[model samples]
Target: TMAGTGAGYDLSTTTFSPDGRVFQIEYAMKAVDNSGTCLGLVCKDGVLVAVEKFLLSKMLVEKTNKRIFPVSRHAGMASAGLVTDARQIVQRARDEARVHTENFGEKIAPHVLAERTAGFVHLFTLYGSVRPFGS
Candidate 1:
């Protein structure tokens, strides 16, 4: 699905079961105008969160900055709207996870990490009036 066009935000959920042995699910929420606000959840052995920022056609030509945030230790996060904000959130999540690991020494669960990421998104929404961008 294409989201963040001139159309309003779109939300969708998809599930995949491969050979009936493994179950995977993905949930996505996207904003209007391609301003690039969105969230994605990937569920495999665990859950991974991804966010993206919006990019203007002109900005795409410059190629000065690119999205590079790790969603989990084994995954990455990206978004389509407000690139700076999405980057900031990813950086903060990495720092927070590092600190938590240092203090807990690997006791943290994947679900907890997912929750933390969601909490950050929630806080951002509470403080700002921006939507997510994606498909």
Candidate 2:
């Protein structure tokens, strides 16, 4: 268990609890798990993304809702975590995809986009000031 707010073990991501658990990392993983599932598939035909809607409201219109988005003509994504954090990743993916097309004259691969997103997310874990993104 977390001993206290100022405990040495609780301060660094490299520190592990008595049970051999990194509390901060586990907490971040749990946050993502609490969100609904996001279905994504890549095949010879195209890329597809689906998200389970949770905050349905009578006054809210479907037209305003924009979860799944097209990164490019052939690629898009739907996320299941913090919307702001997810948007940060989505915007980065869009930038990468655009740069790929501009340089290589081909649409970016889904796996490449996923790898870049993962790499970006990795930073939060290693750095102290930046907290891990739940998305």
Candidate 3:
């Protein structure tokens, strides 16, 4: 059976609208779309990341904001959404890498780190008490 098409469906993260859209996820995407540009490229030697910062306020100090953050010795992330939210994600990623190294006696692989970070972000959308990151 098809679910009802109503605005109420958007209020719950676990509920999908009649068209199969998750409103919370959509909201997060909108936030990212409105933020600074972030991109990455793979070169012959390594990867390169760049972020175009958007200054929205006059009181903000110039050249003080950092959009790229290191998670491990060899891994880092370039973010485009809210700064505080990005910081939380970076911190969680660092912790994940640290814990993986402690338990396995090696650095966390890039794919493993990505999967762990994605799972961590996904959890926020499952509960009503917390909106999805950057949403």
Candidate 4:
């Protein structure tokens, strides 16, 4: 059965009623669900990630890959769909980490990076032409 989209909901990031709900975010989430799979593992030694690779052909030359990426010395992330979007988020995270260390004289912790980046992601869903990141 098909799921019902909420009534009177406008599927645009710029529009919202008094209820303050954005159905466009829901739609973006559904789109993200169709992206590739990515897995992350943390053990005693360090962090490891296994990501899905979609190789088009044997002759396609390798450029910069968009799968696993590093945010800071202590933090990294692996993304599936819209890896370009993920790179933007990662760049934001990296900048935040740098500002944190420059101001506090300490490395940004992984949990802290995650928390701040999550808020950044939420802001994109609330306004502008920005859509949700698939990672």
Candidate 5:
């Protein structure tokens, strides 16, 4: 039913198709889904995170690629998608936490930091000049 109708709209995230689908975001989700597996569990002392990444080459060494990145002393991020995009987001999160600490004289709370990071990521969807984040 919805065949060629998605062609023109899929060009930009700011464009919504007839069925109200943002094709760019849908495609980005697909990319993330194929990246790898990441899991987190709440432990007695703190949360534990694990990542399973597929290496593109047999020559590559294990544990050379990083998937979990530290956002702050109390917060971290596990990303599944493009490494560059994940790094960019993580760097932005670090900047946000640093700014919050500098302004408030206290570390940024996890919820507040999440909200700020989400807000920053949402901007890409609102502008035609930017593509949706791969992660």
Candidate 6:
């Protein structure tokens, strides 16, 4: 799971079971300091997630709302912090996966995709702190 803060702040929590089940909950504030909250729940395949807003609106109230975005049919994202940065990262991953599928055909295994994603994230995290703004 990825998380962090921008525009608004979020307090998020998650739980996982030994049987490969997951549960995530988040509380988001409206402004950087407001007191409202929204809730979200997602269950896909064997993964589950839940989010609760604290001070923020449950749904997008502006055209610029970028907190929650769908990455694929089987994947969606919610940001508790650093919403824009996280969304960009997720979007890039989705785009890369799409490009890979277009080039390599759709027969790739889920494990392969997951491994690639892990490698990408690892590389980013490793070099991010040393690089300028982690291009």
lDDT of every predicted structure (CA atoms): 0.49, 0.75, 0.85, 0.75, 0.88, 0.45
Ranking according to TM-score, highest score first: 5, 3, 4, 2, 1, 6
Error of 5 at 50 (Å): 0.7
Better of 1 and 5 by TM-score: 5
lDDT of 2: 0.75
lDDT of 6 by residue, 29-96 (tens): 22212322334544564654444444345575654645556656655555545455456557666776
Choose 3 or 5, whichever is better by lDDT.
5
Q: Can you write out model 4's per-residue Cα lDDT over 13-122, one digit (the tens) per residue?
A: 77775788676666666645767678888899987798877775678667566678878777788876676778888899999999999999999887888889899988
- How close to the true structure is residue 92 of candidate 1, measured as C-alpha lDDT? 64
What's the CA RMSD of model 2 in angstroms? Answer: 3.5
Clash count of each predicted structure: 19, 0, 0, 0, 0, 18
> Model 2, range 1-135, lDDT digits (tens) per residue?
323642565566767778786667766676678778889777798667778777568887765656687778877778766667788888988999899889999888879888987888898888666677777
Select the stronger candidate by TM-score from 1 and 4: 4
lDDT ranking from best candidate downward: 5, 3, 2, 4, 1, 6
* Deviation of model 5 at 14, angstroms: 1.4
> Which is better, 1 or 2, measured by lDDT?
2
Evaluated at residue 52, the lDDT of candidate 3 is 89
lDDT of 4: 0.75
Candidate 3 lDDT over 1-135, as tens digits, reads 123434687676787878898887677777788888899999999999999887778999987678899898989999988888899999999999999999999999999999999999999988977778882
Runs of candidate 3 exceeding 4 Å displacement: 1-10, 16-21
TM-score of each: 0.47, 0.75, 0.84, 0.76, 0.88, 0.44
Candidate 6: segments with Cα more than 4 A from true spot: 1-48, 56-66, 107-110, 128-135
Pick by TM-score: which candidate is best?
Answer: 5
